[model samples]
Target: MLMRPFWHRRTGRPAHPAAGAPGRPPRGVFPRMGTMTVLPPQIRQQPVERAFHGHVFSDPYEWMRDKDSPEVLAHLAAENEYAESATAHLAELRETIFGEIKDRTQETDLSVPSRRGGWWYFARTVEGGAHQVFCRVPAVSTGDVIADWTPPVVEPGTPMTGEQVLLDANAEAAEHEFYSLGSFDVSEDGELLAWAEDVTGDERFTLRVRDLTTGALLADEIPGTFYGSFLSPDARAVYYTVVDESWRPHQLRRHELGTPLAEDVVVHEETDPGLWLGAGLSADRRWIVVEAMCSEFSEQLIQPVADPSAPLQVVLPRTDRVLYEAEPLLLDGREQILLTHDHDAPNSRISLMDPADLGRPVAEVALRDVVPASDTVRVNGCAVTATHLVVSVRADTTLRVRLLPLAGLGTAAQADPVEPAFAEELYTASVSAAEHDAPVLRLSYTSFTTPPRVYDVFVAGATGDDAALPAEPLLRREATVLGGYDPADYAVERDWATAADGTRIPVSLVRRADLDPAAPAPVLQYAYGSYEHSTDPAFSVSRLSLLDRGVVWAVAHVRGGGELGRTWYEHGKKLHKTNTFTDYVAVTEHLAARPDVDERRILVMGGSAGGLLVGAVLNLAPERYCGALAAVPFVDPLTSILDPSLPLTALEWEEWGNPIEDAHVYRYMRDYSPYENVRALPYPPVLAVTSLNDTRVLYVEPAKWVAALREASTSGEPVLLRCEMAGGHGGASGRYSQWKDTAWEYAWVLDRMGLAGA
Candidate 1:
């Protein structure tokens, strides 16, 4: 899991929510509307002045940073109670929404099995299970290897022969309130299994080994490890990373199977605090790649898996503003490195380098251009198999896959591209899984109105210009909608909204097909415009509750997202980051102007970096939305970016400029930092959700933000904060808890729109 460094710090004895009168509000009346069941929390102000770049600023709620303080805990508890009382009238609605979600989801379902190392691996969930059971079955020898792409049909509640349960997450989480599996890997020989788990909401995980044959745990345990860990090719050792004081993964260490924690050897130590380190095995399973990277640039080192003690070979040196990834491929019976780099190409291009020239400097290496950079296309990712090179690209704000032959490479003419066919224009399709040695490609497809579908495409080894092979449908799970549900009853469409600078921002809309165009419908708009992360249209069973009730759902494909291309992301990040907020506001205004949408009943929602988007938009255009929902929001960017002691702050300097070192960046951030820019104006109702153990975006950010909003906002509309005591950046560890959280949020939105009964 790649945690996004969005940007937060805290002070003061937090104020408790004021006690309510003796009587409660009417059955159907919302407390915040007029009949207040409880007074809003009054956070005490203990201003702390700080000088940065010769400018002075005050943070009144800085004392909230003391998580150990009893006062802080009491304040958080008080806020939770207040939020619950404020929305108590929506309890019935929340239950209804949760029921809808539970009814529509296929509770007892099995994922399509993917073969690896002579085993078909998959995860299955029981009807009432909170977690999935990771399992595998020995693969049988088949004459046609490509045909094995069709997964075995394991009926619900039935066990397959020779089935092996790798790790039952439900059992592991039975004793802990919050449980997360950081990483899990089986040894090449399939005798040993390595897994890391985080019992607390904190990101730190404990690594442990298990004997598959005996189903016994090893005494060797490594604590405070990061998310990813790799099993050595020979299964004698495991490579893992540990976080520095600021919670950045700065060291890669190798732990032998039977060795003590003190005896673990440091494989690589990253000196640059701004770059994070991660390790993984190559697709060929012959080499281990240790990569050091920031948002802008990356450097890779490769060591042969066969010789774990060998010195790492540098694939590329760090270059300013240049990013690239290396993939190992065997071309012409020799090892070659496929490089996807942005060297003189904004959209990036794929090149090949000789592995034999390991001692040569990157600049002196003979690089062969394989996939030329295109002005209209942006290459998202690529994978190399024995015979084909599969590339994932984005064009016209839509995802597409292209397969090219890699048999002859430099000497042979280029082959025709093979693209997977999709039924809808606004759907998403990508290579979900693939075996490096197999010709079968496991592709996944989903749209707003369709559940996820898996397909297997077999390449016939065609290298020349010819018609591409058709994909074979493997499996499609019909989501169990208890009351009766049909995708044909819904409609999904794409539209455009012109930004302030005349840039056309793409927007996807989903609603009931029978929705009346003349009637005003309350809309829920979502956007996540950061880190080049594309927000594709995907099916959500819970969303049916809103769509079925005439509520319109929309996604603003604003700049800063990778939907359109790399250029689109470039235009919305760094100095031009405000474009993301403006683009989202533009989309909101456009949607509000439509005859089918009620301008005063629109809601905006986002999380993480998207939380920053929603916060900034709320400040930029306060009157446009009826309500705003921000989850784990990064509202205090200037303060967080200035503090190098905070987790992920140093690594995030590339995304958000280093305000500590540059006065210009400091002033630029001050202009748009949501917390700093909050005004005493009439604002709409707002709800902020955060987690105490969130390492990426500190919970203090939202805590401070809500306090500031309550003090500054002129509008009497409610501003509430809900803090999850045992959750991390992603709230609620179990499926049931997550559904309940979603229901709570949806109920809030419905209540704010005055459609609680709907």
Candidate 2:
């Protein structure tokens, strides 16, 4: 006997809402401005109960998960139509915001050229073109390495000498409704190119090879390959990964250029459902490095490229709780392994080890520490060039880069590293491109109030860390802004909010300079507190529209993020996950109490895991916000995590506890899960944006959440859901479509803040 859900028995609504008339929706569903009252779509509640670990809960909208069913598709369409009719008044504001964004952006531009072998690689975007054009010019190098490595100056509208167009993505995107480039890699010889494309936005790509000389694709075509696939150094083979039925990338394979698809070899297979596998050629092009990792731990293996069919050697065996990444480096006529690991240091440290000592127990091998661990500094990553090693680190709440010479890299006489100076108090700077043998390191730098800039740091003449190369960084290019823009018009600053546990959460604020803190203004608060992923401050051209309209923007650096270091992330996951939600609420309360902010006009926003944060916080303090935006939210987490067959569900067990095996975890998740905890409160208006093909955080999660909110809310505010019919995790594919998406969201935010007329 099947048991009916509690909601079904309590409400007694019909399973299907009959049309008021033939070929017409219910009268209130698509009401006009002055003609009829606007009503949200009334979703049907089917009888479904999930019983696990002695807990039974009603799932009214579980049928929405069947994405291929006609009923589900029709419901999604109705939801979209309702959202459009409700916001029909904002059509003018959306268009105006989109125009402002397009006007400030230089539609036609060229990126800074980067040197590879004998060519300078760069991308060009023509006006009105939705996709980029990959092209390159012949390289001209002099005997002096520093002078030879400097990037050549090229104007945006002018053509460079000996330039060749490799690929025009516009022509390829014209064939599909949605298009995304999965992988783009050129062989070391610079003659063969390996690329991939995804048309349906499901993220399953098909690989293809192209000859640069003749501009013709070969007969070699492999489907269902993952991103980051690359060609071998000799240009005779390609290496890629394939996802399993659960969408976990677990198989690493190699395909010879002229072989049949069935003959492709599986280099390594990761049977563990919790781990994701990836393979790439080392920077020096001497070895193929394969790695399998999860949120808490990882293991690495390596194979010499000299023997394409050689067996993979274990560089580091799997340890229960230790995480590490090992890269091969050729130094002083010998090969050494550079490892960044969290063995004893919570914030990772760098060390060097010999290749031959691998495959032995990690405790039995000796390691030379090049960059020692520090409680104050978090080493993010390291990159090596022919002359120096560039280490990216997080200190004082911002990302910066340090340079260490390789002359005495692993020895006792190694000199102290050099840290470059930047003018801004908060900025992101890191190595953008570094050819293994190139003399200059290319850096991409930006901040909240600064445009993107490229620089070339000369390091060819330096002998050791203490040696001086060049004091001034050579500026290559700064992204162009079509309209007259001045950084002085805006002000950026940092503030602190006290959490329940006395921890100070960092909050970044940006707005127009003329706005006075004493005068209250509408505010939009954003955050993402999960997966140890940091939401660093960045410059946004579209955001100028919000700031220029006298609205303040804020970013809450809450727990469960890598912003403050490993401990910050540790305190916000698993059992401590509530800290993420509380930290965000604390920040919101702090903003409401500020003299510069209007307490009644504050709005909150987040996407993906951040959307989870938004959902939890709304349930905690719904009155603190006037509106909210959750993009591709993970609302029904316990249900997804309990079922291991779902996409990437097993991989998420480490981040969120295994609710199926642990009783405490199951109850804790149920207490916080947005769909399960939508109590009868005066919930604010919510706009959930999702994609029909988003595999990471499925559209079903948001669909269920919206239905629950509409059912339980005490306030009359509308809860709308906008699902993209043909898009992936990211909404639509092209730049113009993305601009329109941004405009739509921003216009809604302004309307809620009573600034739509501004």
Candidate 3:
């Protein structure tokens, strides 16, 4: 859903403003306010006139886009200094919140182990360690598959009989200021490990291989690679993708061990600038699935893992804008490709097709429907094991997992699917890991009040219970909360907000159980109304700080997100994007009217595309909030989408419409773009956070928006920008540093809500 590939600017239909129309008078030129007061940074206006689609617009502060310039850097530093001075009184509050976050967290912990081949892989986080330690222990197996699949019980910080440390991330990241582990994949035989690291947070990684048995790294060092790199089954080569000049992963390459990097074969290269390329190994490890995808459509290519040099076979040529994921399956002594696709179904469905008919035209090939499309149920994904078909579906606005026996799959006698039961009405359950021969399915479950829990669902060799899944889920572990945290302390409920079009939007809220509804309390409203990414109700250790301080947190499931269904997403994108902003406004009004929420104390927050939502809604109804926080905001959508050279711009055309090629889209985008629509409104105090190295949404966006707000806002509230000098789309990298960032934001929001001393 994010964008870029190199393309020249295109102009379609042309529209222009009146000849005599003049831009806003030069503003934000005020001298230091009263001298004694700490003044915000005063950025010099360097107007750049841009002409596109017969429209000429003047962009002051465009010079901030030159990130390498000394003036821009100095201005950014000054902004940081001003922000620190303005909130200097909150220093104690920030430290207190940080302490609460650290105290409530289990400093030394271990993840639930999952069986892969003969080893049980897991990760450990030691006290005071900023990164995880990847380690594996020998997996013992019995004659029965179900019994053999059980994960061994290992205590935290304890050394096992035969435990091998794969790669200690703390040691690897010790030399870098910012560290991110991109790919950490282990070979099938457990002899080799392929991992990648990004030190600067730009997302381009360097891949390295390690010989686990010898406890030494191999000589293979490949740089400038993207994420999702994997090792071949035989360990002779590694498959990875590389990004182009525009930061789109466009090439899928195979690098053989001990060979020169130049000799690496190009397995597949995506010529379409909008499509991204990535590869993954199938569950059976029989085929390498290379997918070239965009938001609207995708094409999958399959290559036999037995032969690394084999030519790829197309599962289905990119046609009719169909989006599908095909997985190899074995049923009834025959191999078939199971596809969860949106060919004719909006919510999607599961179908079966013969492997031989993969390249045939849609009209020529026959596909048998296994799970028919339903308006109520959206089949999002599927995974196959040696015995069962696992499907993930969203219904009732909650994600659930289902299981179907593979005995008669793709036939008339196929068994009915059974869904496992969960206690909570609003929670997320998903398949975390699935092994080909394993008898158990690893699942991850969480809710607003409940901490994350890992479970193993046993389904193999069951005949007595055909109506329901045979065995009860075995709980492997639940995340540890150090400070006697209890789910009963909080309450969660879903309320409906009616939009202007009479659409009902769902609002999920969590507040302390003792908070009285008769007394209005400050509320923090959050949403990410783009990319179909749902902001589900999940537990957060740091959020407890706000809840304990009488702050209520709520999530608005707006139309642009996939919380409801595909139709909900379709109604809030491209030309219909304004629905996203209006929905947030509706939610704000609804919350303000509630007896439990204070009208003058609500603050808004979102990141990335959600940040755009925050900006737009603030402009629409600034009086509804006390302050706003936008992180790496895509506030300048019109300018970014017009220039295809920017990272991920071309790829974004599918989601936001091709504004460069369409005049209507250009005007529509320009009308509501936060930076373009800044007027003399009673805007609230705003905090914009960004990273200097983020390629997805450049820090320049918030920089420009901050300048425009200062110039146009009628309210004399402070506008602040906090830029991370060495971070990426995500601010700081280490766990400790991330905790501090969270504390800083919480402190700022609390100060705005008059709860800084709470």
Distance from true location, Cα of 621 in model 3, Å:
1.0
lDDT of 1 by residue, 401-422 (tens): 7888886565558676778767
Stretches of candidate 2 off by over 4 Å are 1-36, 462-469
lDDT of each: 0.81, 0.83, 0.84
TM-scores for every predicted model: 0.94, 0.94, 0.94
Q: Which residue pairs in model 2 clash with each other?
A: none
Weakest ten-residue segment in model 1 by summed lDDT:
10-19
Give candidate 1 regions above 4 Å deviation: 1-34, 356-363, 462-482
lDDT of 3 by residue, 21-90 (tens): 1231112221212222688888889899988789988999788999899999999999998888887877
- RMSD after Cα superposition, model 2: 8.6
Model 3: ten consecutive residues of lowest lDDT: 8-17
- Cα deviation at 738, candidate 1, in Å, is 0.5
Give the distance in Å from residue 12's predicted Cα in candidate 1 to where it truly belongs.
47
Deviation of model 1 at 146, angstroms = 5.2
